[model samples]
Target: MTPKQIERIQNKIKKIKRALAADKKHWGGYYHDGQGLRYLPPQFYLEINDYSGAMRYFNWFNKNFEEDSGYPIFLFEWTITLFKKKKVKEAEKKALETFCSNTYLIDVFLGKDMLEFNKNESSNWEYSSLIEHLIYSKDQEELSDFYIWLENFTTSQTFYDFANKFIEIEKAINDEPMGKKRSQLFDEKLKLLESIK
Candidate 1:
């Protein structure tokens, strides 16, 4: 999620519900009113393990916000949730949706496909989310080849700008003292980075 999307999700949990209920008449399309609001319910529901609820929000999101800038984040999160629920086929479909929305994601999530990361953009938080998805799913594809390809692909100066920022974000996440989860994310990212050869 982008900073704006993350802020909205935090706001949804903190303030949006009360604002929406207290002023329903004034809140028409409230969830869809903002740049990233449409992603809130689906991600929140997924966080709580409400797959059906997540699916409902995902359905609505797909119908209404397919072209929204944040749609790829929603699709990626939804794909991870489906994979967590053992819905592999559905997850793959969602993964394809994510790829179609932004092929940079293909570089992050489907690295086994060996596609070039031609875009000049750097590491999106969505990339970390995709890494988490792969970790949680126990994907068996060898990481070394992907890392090699990614290293070479990311060598361009423009991509290096992105990669440097990615390292910063990765370090911050890894250094958070939250517990085993953050540690695992750190470990997984490190393992991949270390595999470049």
Candidate 2:
């Protein structure tokens, strides 16, 4: 929260935003073919209790990228920001928008239904925020609906294609630590897949 910390975080955010701008095609989805933009920089802001900084990242991103292609997780953060600011109606709207965007992939990844399948290569902010919502939700219907979609999608060929690529990529890695992590992740994904019902 010091001036130095703020500057460091701002610099990191600028660097990430520039990188993501250059690689616009790889934005969105559960996987990335390159280093991929992560929710980490913005997440770091949140960790430091810099809610305004986090909102700035989300707002800037939304302005620069298409809603569907921009990181869907940003909406979750936006929703959190809105809620914290006591803009309940706007927060609810953003929350619904977040849930509806990239339905299959986001739900599966954020719900942690097949988290290891993502190789921990992505952000968990969306999951964390959604869990927070679920913890206080007056209605459980949305949660059930989300799992229903996840269960169905996991059974589809689209999900298999995504998983297969992840498997293939991890299998080719020569790094021992990464390989071990991949193996553990693969196992965890399998268990999650089996237990999703």
Question: Largest lDDT belongs to which candidate?
Answer: 1
Q: Cα RMSD to native, each candidate? A: 15.8, 13.4
Cα-based TM-score, every candidate: 0.41, 0.39
How do the residues 99-128 of candidate 2 rate in per-residue lDDT, one tens digit apiece?
Answer: 433333344444545333322334453333
- What local lDDT does model 1 show for residue 155? 54
lDDT (Cα, tens digit) per residue for candidate 1, span 68-115: 545566666776666656676666555545554455554555444434
Show where candidate 2 strays beyond 4 Å.
1-8, 21-35, 67-72, 101-197
Give model 1's TM-score versus the native structure. Answer: 0.41
Report the CA-based lDDT of candidate 2 relative to the real structure: 0.51
Clashes of 1: 0
